[model samples]
Target: MAQTATTGTTVAEVMAELAALEDPRIREVNVRHGDDHGVNLTKLRAVAKRLKTQHELARELWATGDTAARLLALLVCRPKAFERDELDTMLRDARTPKVHDWLVGYVVKKSPHAEALRVAWFADPDPVVASAGWALTTDRVARSPEGLDLPGLLDVIEAQMKDAPDRLQWAMNHCLAQIGIEHAEHRARALEIGERLEVLKDYPTPPGCTSPFAPAWITEMVSRQHTP
Candidate 1:
């Protein structure tokens, strides 16, 4: 791995480090996660720790066309440096659900243009863009829902969730749960919609994990909030 004395680590150095950490078992796991080009999360984190934030380096890494490299790019890219067009490009280029989730959660949601992008993306025809939009909406509702139109969001979920793409459906269901848990005024409506939509009602969850069905998940989260 080449390192500049002044600039620290370059993208090439990080790529070399990632190449060194490649394992067949790790690659198999990554393939199952929808990554055709694989590197383990542990190695990715190790590289990120060593390089820290490097926006320019991230851009270069993204261009290398490796799934792990792109995931690392999302980690290191400066949100402030992102433009809407660039974000759109990244979302389109994301080949896996894991990459799409990270790009939306880690990069797009933190950008200054998040709200505008969220609004535009939710209506987008591309399934990835639409999924990210709902995911962004869920994040906003969970944190600060100052000027958002909650009723409108609920209406959309109720109307479109049934026929939506798999990724978008998951995010929309999550958005419904966030509304029920975070906004007391909308809790009843959100739960009602949850029952009607029955989002993930039959989906299997781990033994100890709460189901992601909005009504159940909302009830659990609200109970926890009041318990302490």
Candidate 2:
């Protein structure tokens, strides 16, 4: 029997530990690491689905175990890429607060999926869930065009905020920041969320170490905000 090695910090060391997984936990942990390192997006998404239903897959997910399932589940749903049922299933089983945020962030970036995303968001029982819902709403507001209905989206988010935790304000506002509101009503809702978050200063983060939104999106949001 091999004893588990205990002192590796680099990703390579981590993979070696995983490959040696006489221990089930170690295997799951390492699979999760591959995701953290640089596995392909579609492959990761496939792994996430298997983890959702299969024990062996779950073992692998747990190996990388760094929230790869959550990240992949969210990535699986994207504009022009995601279908509603898949998104629905992802949200339905995503008990982790961070997974909920990942779903919320993904939904906001998409154009046609808002209503379905709205349904799942409300279904989440956690206050963090509500905040993710609220934040995603802000995104809808941003991309909503001349003919799009802003009032409806605002109505949902505002109603959700009533039940959501105050700590979620920052995430909700950050969602708005991505959208860059245009509709007058949504603009106000975006501002309201932003102001609330700014005042509170404490955003409710989901479980796990990774960020929820895409790297490029963050870069764009920051660049635009900083621009004159």
Candidate 3:
């Protein structure tokens, strides 16, 4: 007989197959969960709805003692539990570096609302989060007509500033490079940020990522800025 899935099983049960609680478990479940490139997003939505309503499942993502389980659970929770309140909850209580990376990247690459994502991004307790969150504002300029706050983000990551991470400086500069493309006045801002990155091409190394980078856009800006 073929192994049959339970009809009455909860969506969580249908999706999550927990191995014994251990570091190795992430590898096991990750393969199983992410195996199909097209994940069953429908079922994931159901599970997220359940977790959003049930504190216990949500708590497991943050409060549970099982580390691997907790990370897996949070990973699932991201696609499913993206409501503003749910994200706020995770931002407030979830401290795992892995989870923060997932959340921040999601907000940067996927969110429909750039401003809303900015709010969620700032919720991270880590300095990396704060830096990335601030940098994200510039990242959105490429996708939005309202444009990015390049000077602000660039200022925050300034090398001469009181305290700044070299990685963040790189990242913010990268984002500025992307913003340079628009036929808008901010092209100057973009070149300024790109020149910053070019300066760092010889630096020892950096910590966090800089902002976004759009090579085509940066090239355009360089050409336009340099044209006599």
Model 3 per-residue lDDT tens digits across residues 132-202: 56556555656663654456645544443224454444445555565566434666655664565454444
Shift of residue 173 alpha carbon in model 3, Å: 3.5
Give lDDT tens digits, candidate 1, residues 1-228. Answer: 445444677767777878887788877887886776567787687777777778888888888888888888888778779898888888888868778888888888888988888989888888767888888888889888888889999999999997888888998999999999999999999999999888799989999899999999999999999996
Task: Estimate, for each residue in 175-208, the C-alpha lDDT of model 2 and write its tens digit.
Answer: 5444433433344445565454343334344565
Best by TM-score: 1
For lDDT, candidate 2 versus 3, the one ahead is 3
All candidates' TM-scores?
A: 0.91, 0.42, 0.49
- Residue 89 of model 3: what lDDT? 56
Clashing pairs in 1: none
Candidate 1 or 3, higher TM-score?
1
The segments of candidate 1 whose C-alpha lies over 4 angstroms from its true place after superposition are: 1-10
Considering lDDT, where higher is better, how would the candidates rank from best to worst? 1, 3, 2
Write down the worst ten-residue block by lDDT for model 1: 1-10
